[model samples]
Target: MTIASCGSVSALTLGLPNSSAVPAEKATLPKGLFVARIPVSAKTKQRLANDIETITMLSLLRPSNTRLAVGTRIPEVLAIGLRLHAKNAAIPTDIVELIAMQRKSGIVFVCVRDADFEGTKRQECAFAVRRALPGRAGHTPTFKVFVSDWKPAGEAMLDIGDPAVDSIDALWESLCSQVMLGSASPTALDARMTRRMQAAQLAEQIDKLTRDHQRAKNPEQRNEIFTKLHKAKNQLEELRKLEA
Candidate 1:
């Protein structure tokens, strides 16, 4: 992927064949991934652009067996990017769509935790990414770092844990190490992800039943929905317990 000027469309370029033609298990190379969103504060926007640039440079220098070119950028590429970065403001549909995009491109996402997570957000976000694997929603790997920790340190002389982030060269070295580690171990997550996926499915079913209950015009229909809703609620409770 080549870096464009800030606010310009970012494009991902991989050296591998079009991923669609190859079986996924055989495609071991990595693709650059960025998530941007609308209505971000100026600080967030600048941070996003900087991060994208860093990813672009890293992608360009990526090793031969490790760099995979997916394709040229499409218009909705930015929208999918937005969805991944929007977090709480992003709905399930947006997340589902973003997951689809990542899966299709065989790219790994990079995300930040909340603003208050401080230097620990990178590890926290990494765990979150690992936890997301069982949903079968996407097939992309993710590497996370704590970029939300920017508060003018003034003259405090900070004791930064990963000083590599202080410059692009150092940061790329860290990222390359991460990619070499490969995707989160699906085997380790299998049992947990299975339970989590079931819980998610039950939650979605409960939501649908509640909506149906609200939309039912007749008392008979409403009663039917209520019965299904009650059953779904119980099932969801069980699923949650299993996940826990």
Candidate 2:
């Protein structure tokens, strides 16, 4: 019921109940929210995406879609799907709660390759998510989930439908179209990317100013551009540190 964790920007739309339906007073359900920190890296996104696509395709190709039922909740369902996909790929994710609960809001998904998914990967992902969260003081219950060590590619392809998009690509597109995982991770990444872009623009401006300052013939003009350049660099540094 409208479960929310502190500092989580990623909202979960799990066909879940809201406060009105589940109610805070009802003590029947779990108390704490689980925050999944997914630390997705740019290096391994394509590989991970392909693997997820393959698993999803295989699942769909199964005679019965509901063969590996996990739970009714969207996260739970996806978690089970991920587990199955990971198992097939020989990937391992060490976490007690496969799915994050509502109590924690921040989940970091990192891109990982098959070779680097083991050891302290989960801790690293969680640390990354915690850094992404706004506050450092609050006690938001959290957990880590690993996406590393996923299969390199699917076993095979099946042309089940009409429009001729590659099955892997199509499956990936379908996963992105989902409400929870789709919106949460991508949206956070989008926000982060936007900040990075802004910082880059500021850095570019500072560089231009530096060049202008050097080219300036007059002392007054040189000093003015230097001041502007200094301010711009400071701003860029601040922007970059927001992620840290």
lDDT of 2: 0.34
lDDT of each: 0.34, 0.34
Alpha-carbon runs more than 4 Å astray in model 2? 1-187
Off by over 4 Å in 1: 1-51, 55-188
Model 2: residue 5 alpha-carbon error in angstroms: 39
lDDT by residue for model 2 over 27-142, one digit each (tens)? 22221122224554453443344443221100111113323222222211121122122322333232222323332322222212223344432211111121222223577733
Clashing residue pair totals per candidate (backbone < 3 A) = 3, 19
Itemize residue pairs with steric clashes in candidate 1: 14-68, 14-69, 15-69
| Span of 10 residues, lowest total lDDT, candidate 1 | 74-83
